[model samples]
Target: MIAEIIPQSSALTKKYTNFYITNLLILKNMGQVLGMISAVLILSAIYFRVGGQKNFSNGLFIVGIIGEILFIAIMIMAIFD
Candidate 1:
C-alpha cells in the first residue's frame, strides 16, 4: 500500500508543476518590451528638454517624468501576473 500511494502522489505533483511552468512563464517578454518603450520615452523627453533649455520645453520635461513613473508601475505589475 505504501509503495503504491507514493507513486500516485509523486505523479500528481509532477503533473501540476509542469502545468504551472509551461503556462505561467511565457508573458515575461511583454514586460521587457514595455520597459524598453518606457525608457525610450523618458530619454526622449529628457533629450528634448536638454536641447531646448527654455520655458517651452517644460512640457517635454513633464512628459519624461510621467513616462518614468508609468514605467515603474508597469514593472511592478509584471512580477505578479
Candidate 2:
C-alpha cells in the first residue's frame, strides 16, 4: 500500500512540475516576443519621425515603452523563478 501511494504521489508531483515548466516556457517566450516587438516599434517610431509623422511616432514610442516594461517585468519574474 505504501509503495503504491509513493508511485501515485510521484506521478502527481511530476504532472504539477510539468505544468509549471510549461508555464515558465510560455512566459519566457512571451518576454522574448515583447522584446522583439519593442525593438520593432522603436525602429518604426524612428522611421515615422524621419517621415514627419509625429503623432504616430509618439504613439508607437508609448506602446514600445509599455512593451519594454512588460519585458523587464518578465525578466524579473524569471530571475525570481
Candidate 3:
C-alpha cells in the first residue's frame, strides 16, 4: 500500500512540475520578445523626435511604453504562476 501511494504521488508531482516549468519558459520567451520590441520602438521614437517628427514620435513613444508595461506584467505573472 505505501509503495503504491508513493509512486502515484511522485508521478503526479513530476507531471505538474514539468507543466509549470514549460509555462514559465513560454512566458519568459514572450516577455523577452516584447522587451526587444519595446526597446526598438523607444529608440526609433527618440530618433524621430530628434529628426523633427513630433507627432509620429509621440505615437511611437506611447506604444513603446505600453509594450514595456505588458512585458513587465508578463514577467510578474511568470514568477507568480
Candidate 4:
C-alpha cells in the first residue's frame, strides 16, 4: 500500500504589518530620516527665497533648487523603469 503524505499547513502566518511597525516607539532607519531632513531643508530654502530675502545664501539656495530638480527627474525615471 502506498502511503499519502499530506503536509501540515503553517500555524505561524505573517501579520499585515511588521511587529515593530505595529508597536509604538519604533525606530526609523537612517535612510528614511535623512531623506525627510533633506526634503525639509530643500523646501525651507525655496520658501525663504520666495518670501523675498536677498543674500549670498540666496545664490546657494538657487543651486540647491536646480540640484533638486535633476534629482527628482532621475528618481522618476528609475522608479518608472
Best by lDDT: 3
Error of 4 at 18 (Å): 30
Sort the candidates on lDDT, descending order.
Answer: 3, 2, 1, 4
TM per candidate comes to 0.45, 0.83, 0.81, 0.36
Candidate lDDT values, in order: 0.59, 0.85, 0.87, 0.48
Candidate 3's residue-wise lDDT over 10-48, tens digit each? 677667666767878998999999999998999999999
Q: Which stretches of candidate 4 lie over 4 Å from their true place?
A: 1-53
Model with the higher lDDT, candidate 1 or 2: 2
lDDT of 2 by residue, 1-81 (tens): 222334435677668667777888899898999999998998999999999999999999999999999999998886577
Q: How displaced is residue 71 in candidate 2, in Å? A: 0.8
Error of 1 at 16 (Å): 7.3
The TM-score that candidate 2 achieves is 0.83
Model 1 lDDT on a 0 to 1 scale:
0.59
Q: Against the true structure, whose TM-score is highest?
A: 2
lDDT of 4: 0.48
Question: Pairs clashing in candidate 4?
Answer: none
Which digits, one per residue and each the tens of the lDDT, describe model 4 over residues 1-81? Answer: 001232234333233223423332122233344445556667777777777765644765666666556556545543442
Give me the displacement of residue 59 in model 4, in angstroms: 0.4
Please give the TM-score that candidate 4 achieves against the real structure: 0.36
Off by over 4 Å in 3: 1-10
